[model samples]
Structures are given as C-alpha cells and as structure tokens.
Target: MSTVEPTATKRFSFMDILKAPLLIAIALIIALLLLGEYLSPGFASGQQILRLLIVAALMGIVAAGQNLVILGGREGIDLSVGGVVSLAAIIAGNLMGGENSGIVLAILGCLAAGAIVGAINGIGVTLLRIPPLVMTLGMLGVLQGLLVVIRNGIPSGRAAPGLSQFVTQPVFLGLPGIIWLWIVIGLAMAFLLGRTMLGYRIYAIGSNEQAAFMAGMPVKTTRILLFVLSGMFAAIAGICLLGYTGSSFANVGEQYMLPSIIAVVFGGTALSGGKGGYTGTMAGATLLTVLQSILTTVNIDESGRQMVFGATLLLLMLFYGRGKALRA
Candidate 1:
C-alpha cells in the first residue's frame, strides 16, 4: 500500500510537470486576448480572432519543422529555413505565373528545391563534420545569393488565383481554407512525433547521440532526415506566404526565421534538443500571434514593437537556458 501510494504520487507529479508549459501558453494566449479586447473595441471579435489564428497557423507551420530539427539534437538548428522559404516562394510564384494550371508543378518544384538545400546541409553536418550552425548559416547565404542572381533584382509573376482564394477565402465553419490546411498538417505532425518509431529514435538520439549510436540507432540518418523535413516544411510555409501575399519578393521569408525559432523555444522545446513537441509549439505560435495583435491594437510603433519582441525573447531564453544548463 505504501509503495502504490508513492508510485501514484510520482506519476501525478510527472504529469503535472509535463503539462505545465502548455498550460502556461494557453493562459498567456487568453490573457493577451482579454488585453486586446480591453484596449481596442472589436479586438476579440470573431473576425479579428480568426485573422490572428490564421497568422498563427502560418508561424506554426514553419515552427513545426524547426521543432523536428531541434528534436534531433547535436545542436541541430536550421538557419537556412528563411532562405529556403524565400527561394521556394519565388520559384512557386514564377512557376505558377498567375495560373491555376501549374500550381501542382510549382508546389512540387518548391518542395524539391527545399529538400535539395536541406540535403546539402545534412551532408555538411554529418559527412564533413561541419557544425550545424555554420553549415546552415553558409547555406542561407548561398541560397540568398542564388536568389538574387536568379531574380536579377526584379521578381516576376503572381500567386495563382485559386491558390490565393484557397488561402484567403472562407471555408468550413467560416474559417479560411489555409486555417484548415494548418490544422491538418499540425495533426499529421503531432501523430508523427507522438506515435511513430521514427519519433522514438529522434528523441533517443537527441537525448544522447553517442548513447543512441551505441544502442544501434541510425543517428546520422535521422539527423539528416530531420533537416530535410525541416526544409520541406519551410518550403510549404513559403508557398502559403505566396498565397497570402499574392506575390513574391526577395527576402520575403526574412520575417519568419526568428519567429519560427521563438515559437519553438517559447513552446518549451529545448534549443539544446530532445525536450519538446509540436503541441507546445502550436500553443506558442498562437500566443505570439495574439500578443502581436494586442501590440498592434495599442498602436505600438515599429521600433517599440521590435524592442518588446527582442526583450521578450531574451527573457524566455534566460528562463529556459537556465533550465537547460541546470539539467546538463
């Protein structure tokens, strides 16, 4: 009877600790929304809320990929995601040429491009023993340079009409089709991370790569695959951005890089790796979106917004960074 009581207490304590971050994110989201409502009339109205969710969905999509790489450990990070996103959007735009007929091809091309870039990063990290950060940072520069050469300072084409409509137009339950897309993708990613052997291996490797390798896990391959997947997700996000903006521009993805990282980290995912999931990332994304809306409603200028954003990220990093250091 005493043993059983201790076991139950341990289990309950573990569950509470596991749920704490997600609960905090949810609470923050609600608090921000309430604040928005107080500061601006109609701030919490259905339409405005839906818009915020839509934006959050975009960030969540990108963060989903970042989550995977971070989960792969070895200081895995994809700084090239922004460049891949920009390249994918530009390619998709040019390929689609404002026509629905080529949308499929455009999408495939963007994904392929992303995969190739990711593969390069993987090779550098795994085969050449290059650091992940350096490899990805170099890739980012290369991709940006290539994009500039390709576009020659002038980008062309527009988003396909159908694609644009799908993203912006209302669909089921008055939500935009893009929101539905995000939900579907999020569910799939959740299932992949939570219910699959691959996910198990990823966590194992992230927890301790040398130990995982000794235990016969395919550490190198898994890390490479994670990078590839991250690139693909970034490409998908770029495609969505194209739909949202209805045009492509150089460095269009510049805005997403930090936000995606922030979303992942804010969701309790460890930058050192192996300690978080997409669920928390989703909540974090929503929280950031709502916070942005609140700031905008309060008429915060661009410089003020950037200052607040940086300060917030710094604080979160300190909070989580300490935990990571302590654990180490």
Candidate 2:
C-alpha cells in the first residue's frame, strides 16, 4: 500500500481573523435592536437608528485616534486626547464665530492646536522616554488649566453656522452629512493602517520594537508621527462635535475619554500593543452607542447605567483576553 502523506492546514486569512469579532458585534447589535423594539415599538425605526449612528460617528472618530496610538505599542496611549478635543472645539468655535467665512481659519486653528499638542507629546515620549500615560496625563492637566485661563472658566462661542448645518442636515438616504464624513474618515484610516508602509512599520514596532529597530525602521520618527496623527484625528472629532452641538464648552470632551479607550479595547486591540485594526474599533463604537440608547430608553438611572457599562466592559475584556491567551 502507498504511504499516505499528511497535508498542512492552511492558515486563516485576514478576513477570517476579523470575522469572529465582527460577527459578534453584528449579532449583539441585532439583539439590542430587537430588545429595543420590544421595549418601545418605534425604537428601531430608521430615524432612531440613524441618530444612533450619528452619535457613534462622533465617538468613532475619537476612538480611531486612540486605536492608532494603542496599535503603536510600547505602552502607547493618549490620555490627553479628551483635553485636545476640548481645546480644539473651543478654538474652532471662537475662530469661526458662526460665520461661514471663518470656517477655513477655524479648521486651520483646530489642526494647528492639535498638532502642537501632539508634537509635545511625541517629543516627551520618544525623546525623553517618558511613559506615555504619565506624559499624556500631565498634558491633560496642563490643557485643562490653559483652557480655564483662556476662557475664564466660562465657555463663550457659537459653532460656525455653516459647519453646524452641514453636520445636522440630512443628505442622501436620510443620513446626515456627518455620517458620510465618518465613512470617508474610516476608509482613510483603514487604508492607512492596512495598505501603507507606515502601517507596516507601526505594526512591526508594536509587535517587537527591538526587532523593528534592528530591521532599519525609523522607530522614533514613526512613533512621533503616530502621536501627531492621533492628535489631528482628535481635533477633527472635536470640531465635528462642536458642529453637532452648535456650541462648545470647557468640559465638552470629558465624557469621551473612557469611551474611546473602551471602544478600542472592546474592538479586540491588545492593551499591551500590536495586533488590531480600525474595523474592530468601529464595531465597538457602534455597540457602545446602541447600548447607550437602550439604557436611555429603559430609563435606567445614571448609577445603574454606569454599573451596567462597567460590567459589560469587564465581560468584553475577559472575552478578548481569553482569545489572546488562546492565540498565544
């Protein structure tokens, strides 16, 4: 008899790797929609869903930046992102003053402010070897103080009318322009992380920094650029938020910090670094927004809602944590 040869099993494709979490997210979303419909017949209507997407878009934008930072490895994170958002909104609002003509300057100002903060963060982390957490936290305090001094603890400015109208006005398919903006931004981010040399270097450094350095990667430059990109993304999010709200405030970005981190982690990014993508973060953002809607519909008290949020986050962490261990 002829000897039988054993064939090697094929490794899973990238899409296959993504499908697990993506499917779970979709299922969870559907379940939530059903529950919402049961609790309130109109809860799952198209309009309601679109509203949820709008809110998700806001969080998604900020979370995208956090996602990038976390993906860069070496204890990377940006605690000051919330502060950046707040300052960006304030700057944009004041510069625009509800005037269409001021939109250009407003945008430039927001980006500049974000870039400056990001540069400082990059310098501190890459050059000084400061822990990212400590650096960003200190920066956060500084920004909070700066904003207070700038505004005298009183927020004073209206969002640009043109910007506000653009974000709020429904366009094709009954979706606001902001949603399209989110989609474009999401696509751009996906391309950046998956299709560019920069993306490859980011993952390489994240996976093993010493190895990446030995392989001739500009480790410091790449890390610093990651911070810069993160800051820019945060600024864009802040501007969109101001447009959505038609105004800006000192604490406007406060609620987003934790949510951004949660969304990034829940989307399956490893806290230790490396091995994740924007797709998971987007799904996480959607899930969070939907959960918020459910909590509101059920009239859950703030304390109860917080408890549920914490519990849910813990479960997600454990779930993904197990997956990570298994892969190891």
Candidate 3:
C-alpha cells in the first residue's frame, strides 16, 4: 500500500486537506473564528483577531518547547512548563522593576534560570533514566515551592514599561511585538526541523530510538538539548505574559501548563511522539484560544472551562494510548 502523504504534493484536494491533521487544525481555527463572530458581533474583527492571536502567540511560544521535546521522542515532555513560566515571570519582574534599563538583564536572568532548571531535568531524564513524565512532574512541584520561597507567598514586581509596550503596542505591521516574535520562532522551528542536522537526528530518534542509537546518534545529548530549549521557550513566554498582564504573580502561569500540551496535541502532534511540527501547534494554539474566548462569551465560567480542557486532554490521552495498536 502506498501512503498519500500531505506533503507529497504542493496541491491538495479537498479530501486530502480533510485527511491532514495540520490542515484540519487550520480549518478548525477558521471555523472557530467565524463561530466567535457569530456569537459576538465584531469578535472576528481584524483588531480582535489580532488581540486573540497575541494570546495564541504566547501559548504557541510555550508549546514550541513542548513540541521539540515531544519530537525528540522517549516520551519526552515538560510538565514543568507552567512552573518554569511562573518562576521566570516573577524573577523577571523583580529584575526589571518596571525600568527599561533593566529589561535586557531581566530577560537574561529569566532565560538562565529556566535553562538551569531544564538542564537538571534533562540530566535526570537522559542520564539517570528517569521517565520524562515523572521527572518533569516532580520538577513542577519543586518550582512551585521555589516560587513561594522567592516571593514569600506574595506576588510582586512589575513589567518594564517598554516590555508592556512591546506586548501591547503596535510595533510592526500593526501587530504587537509578541506576534512578530512568534513568527520568528515559527520560522526558526521550520528551519531547524526541515534543514538542520539536529532536526534530522531528532526525527530519527523519535521514529526509532534503538535504531537511532545503533546508527551512532547522540540520543541523550539531543534529548537534553530539547528540554533545555523547552525551558528557554517557556521562559520567553513567561516574560511576555508578565508584559501582557503588567504584573508578576506566583501563579500567573498556572493556567498554561495543560493548555500548552493541549495546543501541541491539538496541532496534530501525536503525544506518542515521532510525528508533528510547529506549524500544526500554531494552528492548535489559535483554535484553542478562539474556542476559549467563544466559551467565555457564552458565559462558561472558569470552572466550566477547566472541566472542558480536562476532558479534552483526557480523551486525547486515551486515544494516543491505543495509537500503536490502532496502527497495527
């Protein structure tokens, strides 16, 4: 049997588009956008869509790291993303003190802190043979505790004026800085996954770890690098979140942990790993964000939304759990 791959041709028939996960995700995004507009007048306005896109951009940034780790195989995931994001935001807030002069240093500090946490996680998983789920989950708790110690159970600090402006004010093409940043990230991910040696090796490991190892790939190091990158991406999101909200809080990023994963899966990245890309994740993030907004517009309370998210994730996990058997 021959597989009609989506990428096999530049042109896709309607049936082919329907069968492609990435295309499905994009279609869902458009459908949801229109749905939102139907539910609330002006919801699909250019300005409103841009605003929602910024929110999706933040989620996409965080999911970017998750995408890579999952792509690296070995059940690799970063459950600690929310904690890393919260920690980075708090630390960046303190470092920035709302001053432009401190912006660069705050960014450096947050990225470094996130990278260290990621390095430890990578070492634990890659070298110590700790399961990715267990390792990242444990790190989440540690980071939460650390946040308390750092802020003494109180949320403090402010995003620099410049930072806030970047996130909220138009910078280029009438889009905020975060949108531009997200574009850069998406482009970079495409290049890394499509053109780089590291990208090929990552895909190789994900497809078959034992075979990759036999082929002399540095599997462990690549996995470690993926986690490190994940941490850094989460940190960047944290920084952007701080700017968007204009304040730093202990639990500011608490909401993103599962959503990041959801975005990755919804974007058509299989939780079982070995097949996915940032493009799908971007569409997933946008669709999720728009769907959430529509839900809110319809008066779904926070708890209700949480339930929906939880249920969605549960269903996906169950499906993926049987993926191999299904394929067989």
Q: Quick one: best TM-score, which candidate? A: 2
Tens digit of lDDT per residue, candidate 2, span 157-210? 788778987787797777798899888987887777777788778887887889
What's the lDDT for all of these models? 0.83, 0.83, 0.84
- Candidate 1, residue 149: Cα displacement in angstroms equals 1.1
- Steric overlap count per candidate: 0, 0, 0
Between candidates 1 and 2, the one scoring higher on TM-score is 2
Runs of candidate 1 exceeding 4 Å displacement: 1-18, 315-321, 324-328
> Whole-model lDDT, candidate 1?
0.83
Give model 3's TM-score versus the native structure: 0.90
lDDT of 3 by residue, 113-141 (tens): 88998999999999999999999999999
Q: Which ten residues in a row have the lowest lDDT in candidate 3?
A: 4-13
TM-score result, candidate 1 = 0.91
**Model 3: how far is 199 from its true place, Å?**
0.3
Put the candidates in lDDT order, highest first: 3, 2, 1
As a TM-score, model 2 comes out at 0.91
Using all chains and alpha carbons, the TM-scores for the candidates as numbered come to 0.91, 0.91, 0.90
Q: Largest lDDT belongs to which candidate?
A: 3
